[model samples]
Target: MSTSVPYFHHFQKDTTGIERPVRFTFPFCYDPHELSILAAEQVQTYLAGQNDFIHNFGLMDGQEGLVIGKMFGVLVVQDQEGNLGFLAAVSGKMAGSNKHRYFVPPIFDMLDPEGFFLREEEHINQINRNIELLQKSAELKELRENLVQCKKHEEQILSERRKLHKKNKAERKERRIAQQPCLPEQAYQELLEDLIKQSYRDQHHYDVQKEKSTQQIKLAEDALNHILDQIEELKSERRTRSSNLQNQLFDQYHFLNARKESKSVLAIFTESKNIQPPAGAGECAAPKLLQYAFNHQLTPICMAEFWWGSSPNLEVRKHKNYYPACRGKCEPILGHMLLGLNVDDNPMLENPAADKELEIIFEDEAIIVVNKPAEFLSVPGINVKDSVQTRIQNRYPEMDSPLIIHRLDMSTSGILVLAKSKDAHQFIQDQFIKHTVKKRYTALLDGLISGKEGLIDLPLRVDLDDRPRQVVCYEHGKPAQTKYKVVSIEGKNTRIHFFPLTGRTHQLRVHSAHQKGLNCAIIGDDLYGKRADRLHLHAAFIQFVHPLTKSLVQFEVKDPF
Candidate 1:
């Protein structure tokens, strides 16, 4: 640590365009990596003292609980020249300074009502409100709707008049042909003429009404179009004004790089491929830490982000555990900000699965079932190349087309089915698609469950921003169903049996974790619950009618935990 830094000055220009010294404590400068190690060690020591969890994770019965909330830490660094800083950020959220006295304040302090940025934001919001109002204006809507209704009614009236005329004409012709000749020729001609005149009168009456309706409708439509044009013109003007203001606001958001040079929002993003600034550029914890350091001329060393709140129901997070920045949110922005800094790798993907032998439970010429160990992927995935299929291919060098029939979560352990022949694969796959294949699993729930047994039907879809994780959404998700029965209950835990009626990604884990379903995640589920040595859920049993033999087959494996 440098003893030289007693104090440092940092400033930001307000909405009034006045640059003034910012009032916040500057973190002490140190080796970033060294600082990270020290901070993590300190956090670890503190966690060890807490009874909320056990330190020995990844061991069955050795580690027994979870701690809620994630924490973020930073190690301020200083270079020899100390030109200082760049703007950057990490994934997750910030622990606000107001809530935690030891924490740093937000970059813009948006909560400050008197702040210039907040005022500007309010102006932008007002513009948005006006645009919304224009879109839903009742007066404009009524005018357009009335025009549409009038036009439709006129068309219907015209068609009805024409149909009646056709019917009358046919009737008149029928009378002329069926009845013997009328009284006198002149009288008959006169009667026919009269009949034609009556038809014409009906047509004329409706046509007059249609013309009046059309004229009124046209007037209303013209008014509506004018109003629409005015709204569009206003919207265009607002967009131009908004764009200029936003561009100015973005320019004010200058970030520091490792070399301690400031770059405006426009300069940084526009330099590379003309991408627009991310919606929330300088708001994240990493950026705030970096910005604070650079403004105060502190060296950036090493930093880390950890989740501090209750884990989101769908995404995996452990309180106090260190993690990497989310790739989707932070990568591009940080790529521009950390132009020269030597950033560390993401700690999450560092642990790749090693070669584990496939546990073959059953094998036939048509089909084979194996018990896949947890941490091994059912099939190859991005960043996960060595999977069950690759291992199977190695073992069965002579195997024919598409041996894999079904899959399991990489973190889940259980029975995995594989086909030896293409015909067998199709037959078994057909059974799954038809819901004829039945599978049962055993899981250890994190907490006591309310129900002894029940069916869970949840619609699940992938969370695109966060890969590999699935979310339960009724609107866009696919149908997933599971039947669970309580097997036993232990201290702070419940044992249960799950019979899945439909197969979906993370179906069992999501079914257990989602609030609507079991409401208790499987114990040791890192993505859904707390991180542990292994995910406690396992595929224990499976049954289906044989494709080749035309006989039913059921296979069950004993639960390891």
Candidate 2:
């Protein structure tokens, strides 16, 4: 196997060897030969000093990067001539170094002002501005005002007619009431005659008002329809123009992959079974590394990618964590690119021991408490069903009343509480809701914190694009609170105690990993920190009022680390 250390050198290629057509593809700016030669030294330094496999992160406090990132690198190999060079990449978006001396250039940079996409986009913007200006057209404004005036005039006439009708009704009621029980023949006759006259007058006035309203409304309707027709015509014209421009822009966008083959937007869709290009294609790290290699005729070796900076709100990402090329996007395109090249299997996607035995710590008729091992799932997942709930169902087939009430991260190992009866389950869960259940977690933070203890109040939301990864977002996030205290210092690593107030998903993990928060990812965190055998976070202690006995009961477990 080649050494983990990076080796970079120039591998000259003929510029006149292949001619590319005039097409708009992702812009890549880097001399493959020059980059390989330059980037290898940094790779070597990183592998030799940091990625020794013996030296892991989160062990010492006050270190540079506790949540160290994974690196996806390409070591372009050409064994025929005994020439060597390497290219480097980190997973996700790194804080700095996208414009590093050694990195490959982007496929398409829409940020350029001269770019056709940007120019076309400006056209679309101008079209929108025109549409807005059209809404304020004098012709349309006059039509609207005429309609409003017509409606107001009609309403005023109807209101006056209603008032006349009301007066006529009141007069009729008064005349009838006066002749109620014992009315003289002459008096009754007079009231009847008077009421008939008033009714006829009211009816005549109402009919005149209605006729006037109908005529005015018809005229207004005809006028309004003409204005509406004009508006719709204008909209249709704008839409057509916009659609034509969009098509032109799409036609102009051509993308190049690792094969150094350029294809238009339509061609790419026609080639693939998918209706559209997968999201965030061409821009990912894997494609960048591969494209750089293919352009220089460099052979593919092995590649690794790591993430840096804050995790996106949708996906599960941690700084310095290794992640495979996204399957949805990179797979189909890379499948075409890496057709005959002997590529290594991605280890990041492999799951060796998904199912493991559970160790029960304490059990009773009301509840059962167990010591959960790391790498074991708490509940059944969409893809994997080897969870604590599944295991319990398998172990206790005859007993099924209450179920798993709480959850722990699959990478976390510690005490877990389960209820045997529905009553106990509701009571226990209620305590959690009321914040009466006190829970304490122990974690080995990657960095040494300055303050011994403090509170972290940050809102968290799951990254929809990446499951199980949470991000700190104030606008759309759940309120999360965590109180932490430094337990002990092991070399540079600090053992800490966590008291979480809200049970948000990945609450503690996000809080610790976020820069504004603790900025210390738990040890062995694949998503947020350096990967190890297991995440160094455990639920150590839990105390709550007993449902059956009405007494406070507490449970504690020893730290595995």
Candidate 3:
């Protein structure tokens, strides 16, 4: 607490035995370095005993306000004098303030009373209030109701007129048909002329009535539009002001890289994706940490981010568990900030299945079944193009249809069915689409499950902030259901069978890891759980009607682990 630097904290315990990491941590996906973990442990210890703050993390009872957990980060940094220490940061504001005595300050503080953000925000809020007041006014309400009634009245009057006109025309037609056979030629002509005159009179009356009704409706609509126009003007002004303020704020968030080069948030995003920076782009823990390190002349060694307190309702977050920096917000920011520093390479760029081979389990003229190895891609990916699909297409040059009928996660090893012809593909793909294809996956869970068998009905969607990682989102997610039966309990791991009823992306993995489902992560699930040698998930059995013979066919492959 008494260091020369306000946010820097030296290690309380002896650290002579631990070696410093040679390169900085990769923010997106990483295992926390030992030093980074130690720094985080110390920060957590301070959080436990602190009395200066009142944020409700939902860790203890009787805490006031919303139960929002936070992502805390630790950056292992060395000072200008080569002193080993670390800096801590929270993702956003803590206890409604950006300045904490023990943590690094935000890249830009929008909460400052003298700042333009607050002043402009207040103006926008006033616009909102004005719009709300006008919307709720009795005059506006009455106008809206009057317009509705006017429309109804117009419809009723027009309907009656049309009905009467139709009836009169039908009667005239009947009279003409009956009179034509009985009356003399001159008499029939006179009768026809009289009927025509009657029809013209009816038509004239209907047109006059229609014009009157339309004018009434138009009058009501104009009255409503007068008030609505004012409201719309205010809304348009508010939108323009809000957009300008956001752009100004983005400009104010200047970030520094290891090379001492500076760039605003707006420039960084513009250069990267040609889009405006997302809200809270520069406010993440990683950006704040790197910004402060550069400003204070601290050499960043490694970094780690962890969640503390209760998990979010839609996303899975465990207390005190390490998480990668979000890709959506921090990827571009860090891409600029980490320049000139020797950061670890992104692991996603490396193909895990580059050296692994795809084993053919069964094959025929119409279809091919392969025992796909773990860490293999079902199809070509962004960085790596070598996959089962590519290999199969190369092997069978004469096959004209898309080879993969079904897919497995790159980390998942299992039986995959491929089609040789377009007809075969459609026939089998239809079965999967209709949920008629039965599949069973074998997975080793990191934790023991108590129940024997149960259904997990958690919905899933891709975490927009982190690609490829799915979160449980009821509002926006596709239905994902999995039935699991525990096969055996081995010391600390539970082997289970998963029968997925829906084929949503990462369905089985998210269902197993989510707290609402099994509350256990699949072993070696790097995206949802801790990293290990390989993901312990396999498509062990599959059953479907053969596309060629229209006969029930099944395939089974034993899992390696």
- Name model 3 segments beyond 4 Å from true: 1-3, 154-214
Tens-place lDDT per residue, model 3, 411-509, is 899999999999999999999999999999999999988899999998888988788788998899988889989999988999999999999898988
lDDT of each: 0.68, 0.67, 0.91
Highest TM-score among the candidates is held by which one? 3
Candidate 1 residue-wise lDDT, 1-561, digit = tens: 233333221112111232212221121111234335444555445444545332233323434444224435554445346522122232233322222333455555544567665676677677678768877899878987877887888788778877887887788778766542755878777777877787788778777877877787788789788878877876787788777766766766777766777777666667753777766666666666666666656666556555554555445555554555444334545565576666544433443567577788888778888999988888887666788898888888998759889999887899999998888889999999999988889999999988899999988998764456688877889989999999999899999999999989999998897767787889877566655667899999999988788899999998989
Ranking by lDDT: 3, 1, 2
Root-mean-square deviation per candidate: 10.0, 9.7, 3.4
lDDT of 2 by residue, 514-537 (tens): 777887888887666666667999
Best of the candidates, lDDT = 3
Question: How does residue 238 of candidate 1 score in lDDT?
Answer: 72
Give candidate 2's whole-model lDDT: 0.67
Task: Output the worst ten-in-a-row residue range by lDDT, candidate 1.
Answer: 20-29
Q: Which whole-number lDDT from 0 to 100 does residue 187 have in model 1?
A: 74
Candidate 3 residue pairs that clash: none
